[model samples]
Target: IGSRFSADTFRIRDFFAMNRVNFTWIDIESDPQVDELLKQLQISEGDTPVVAFGNEWIRRNPTNRELAERLGILSTLKEEVYDLAIVGAGPAGLAAAVYGASEGLSTVVLDRKAPGGQAGTSSNIENYPGFPMGLSGRELAGRMTLQAQKFGAQLSTPREVVKLEFENGYPVLYLDHDKCVSAKCLLIATGASYRRLNAEGREQFEGVGVYYDATPIEAELCGGSLVVVVGGANSAGQATVFLAEHARKVLLLLRGDDWGKDMSRYLSRRIEQTKNIELLTNTEITRMTGNGHLETIEIRNNRTGETRMVETRAVFTFIGAVPHTEWLPEGIETDEKGFIKTGSTVMNSPLWTAQRRPHFLETSRSGVFAAGDVRAGSMKRVASAVGEGAMAVAFVHEYLKEM
Candidate 1:
């Protein structure tokens, strides 16, 4: 149980949802029986957001690491040196894990958060092959994770690879809390993060008023309330449709007039047909105003010089994505936008030390490969990422023969 406006509650809920943990949330402020339940359990309101497991154990506002450990989802390195180390647990990494482990390679997949990465937050994906009715991103990720684990792949969660070094021409990863691991061949599939909304007071209102993904937890908070969605991409389109079902009304704010330019046709058609979603083109948020949470936002029309106030409690941003490559080592070459360079691009880099040309997905360093949205010139799609991942494993086999 937790307060409706608590950021910590949102964080916990998001983490649980991303990890596919089944739990029900109770609002202490709204639930009539919460006070009595808390009294019986000897939990004060000050120590709220208590996580109860089967009526026997409870933790009040526990950290993510603590919760992960309790759920038995967190994993530790098993072998001294794994045959293959996959970074990021998104589609690319998970796909590689399934193929690598099935081929008898000792593989371990590491991710800072849950298995899904940004795609995990998607409400619905229709274009992916198979599944005519479509499926939620969490369900797809969960299935992929289970398949990989079924093939003997070790999936480690809530672990960040902070630094990288080389020992005997093999990659050594430095993780958080002074933990480190080594692997014969490394796969860099650490995907991208949603670009932050540039509106005023965005940072202050984050987790409280502003959000990046529209999950069921956020949907509950915005029920019967006005919510705003920003961007013109497929992510924004998906959010607009998903939240429109719960929110009283949704305002889709776009900086450009052509909303369908970056979004899929089906989503754009749905937005047009939805009665609750108001499409605001050539508009941008100028300021965000609220007392402690979010209350109102000032928006402007770039073409008409008209300004208006939009009263909203939540704002979901899906503008674009920036690769999570800042922590990557200098040996890996990236393009101007920081996406990892692979194949022919890597061969042209001065860091290419291998006598033979690097494989299709190989990076500048030998025995290292990159795939998914993190790689430059890659098609940013779930199917393509999965394909690249499986193909990268094929290249790993060729690289292993030389070693």
Candidate 2:
């Protein structure tokens, strides 16, 4: 149980939701029985956001890594060397696992947090082929996870790769806890992260009032409260539409001239049809003010130079994304934006060591590949990520032949 304003509670909830863990949340502030329960457990209110495992035990304000360990989602490596090690659990990585493992390659997928990267947090994906109606991001991830596991692909969650090294010409991944795993072939699908909101006080209210994705957990918090959404992309358009279902009003602020230009046509139409959503073009948040939670926001029209204050308790941002390449080693060349350089680009890089040209999706470091949103020149679509992921496995087999 936890308070409504507890940032720790918000993070736990987000983690559980994104990881598809089924749990009940009891609001300590609103629930009357929480006091009696705390008394029975001999625990104080300050020790809230506690995770209880039935009546067996409870951890007070536990971290995500701790919870993941308790949940058995984090596993210890048993193999001395894996045939293929995928460094991400996103669409591309998961796809690779499914293909690699099924094709008899000893594959293991590791992710710092949970599976599903940025796309996994999406509320709904309508444009993806099949499931014409649509499917939730969590559902898509759950199915893929099940398929990968069924094909004997090992998935280790909450396992972050802190550093990379090459020992005996094989990539060795140094994890968060000084643990290391080596692989014959590696696929770097560490997808991108959403850019943070630049408005003042944005960091302060991150979990308190500001959010990144419009999942059901976040939408529940919107209940009758006015909320704000920022961005002009399809993700922003999706958030505005979803929030409109629970929020009293939704103010969508965009820095671009035309919202339809960046967002999907269907989502743009849905936003236009939604009565509660008000689109504010060429506008941006100037400041966010609140005592403990978000209370008000100051927005300005870039063209008009006029500013106004809007009362809101929540703001969701989906401006853009940056690749997760900071932990990557030097041999893997990257574009100006940090997305991994592959294919012909790797052949042109000075880091290329092999006499033969690098295979498609192969990085400058032979036997290492990149796919999904992290790859330079990627399509940045779910279907494309999946295809690239499967295609990368083909190159992995070719690389193995050379070995």
Candidate 3:
């Protein structure tokens, strides 16, 4: 009996194949009894890859190297605990790791997926300081990662925090499948996820054409192709301008009549002058059609009842972002939109406080703090996130001293 696989599994398998790893390739999707075996293994819905090493059940994408290390299949198991565990590898998380580790606080950074967070998907960031020539978001993230690692900060990518519990005044993080580690201080910097389109065939064309982040590698696939960018925000404008260089043509779709006022005036001016870019106001994508890849998109003019079809190869949507705090238990004191609330408030308020009134970055649960884009009133800029990350560490220091 074989196991089912997901698109991520296929990608991982391809990567291993290129490395010439000895392994049998099986497509459980072609097997009739695969579903029954999946149920027996307690696999839930969603396309996931499963591997069976004898009687042991391994689900999803697991590296052979990791399996070897875990099962004493390799020479040794890597140490996992650290003095400071920074969740989320975005600007704030990266900054915290770099600073925390350099200050001699054994630091470890972990992210559910790949590093870079939302900023990692950015095509280019022109506003971050110290880069007069401007830098790609991926490049910036890579540099930060390198700097942190260089200073002895251990970073674990593609790791998810299944559970976080405070044990004896220390934060204990549980990894996938019950692997646990305790830390002196914990920084919740998991960042946010991009809002997805609620249209049909959207999931089918995810990597084939639909992308949330407009990175350079993703843009490379759009060479000579027509690309559609969704949203009126700065991210959308930046992606539109970036894709214009590689794509044959770019369409900027905005549900509102005007572009977001928060976008830089310089970027708005550049968008207006870019002939390859077409600005569509008061319009939205109604539906997309393709066999396995995106071939055409149907857009609707909200003000007018007219609909239009554009043959595009790729779609980059930056409609908005939502906090990735679903794993957090209730009573965290988030706003209506789910952003974590910070700052001290009036006395005798319902909000939990460690030592003062309104708690600063402290969650509804005492001692737990939130920072960066996940926190309310965050500036949401790369520089701002970095600053907040370092600031959060200071608060953690204070919180520890009080404890």
Candidate 1 stretches greater than 4 Å from native:
54-56
Task: Name the runs in model 2 displaced over 4 angstroms.
Answer: none
On the 0 to 100 scale, the lDDT of residue 399 in model 3 is 66
lDDT of 3 by residue, 367-386 (tens): 56677888878888888998
Between candidates 2 and 3, name the one with more favorable TM-score: 2
TM-score of each: 0.97, 0.98, 0.80
Best candidate (score: TM-score): 2
Model 1 per-residue lDDT tens digits across residues 1-403: 8887778888888999999888888888799999899998898999988888877779999988889888898886774999999999999999999999999999999999899877788888888899888788888899999999999999988988999899988899999888888999999999887888777887878888899888787898899999999999888999999999999999999998976999889999999999999999999998998987899999999999899998999999888779999998888999998999999888778999889888999999999999999999998888899999999999999999998
Deviation from native of the Cα of residue 153 in model 1, angstroms: 0.3
Listed per candidate, the RMSD to the true structure in angstroms reads: 1.3, 1.1, 7.4
Clashing pairs in 1: none
Question: What is the TM-score ranking, best to worst?
Answer: 2, 1, 3
Off by over 4 Å in 3: 1-81, 345-353
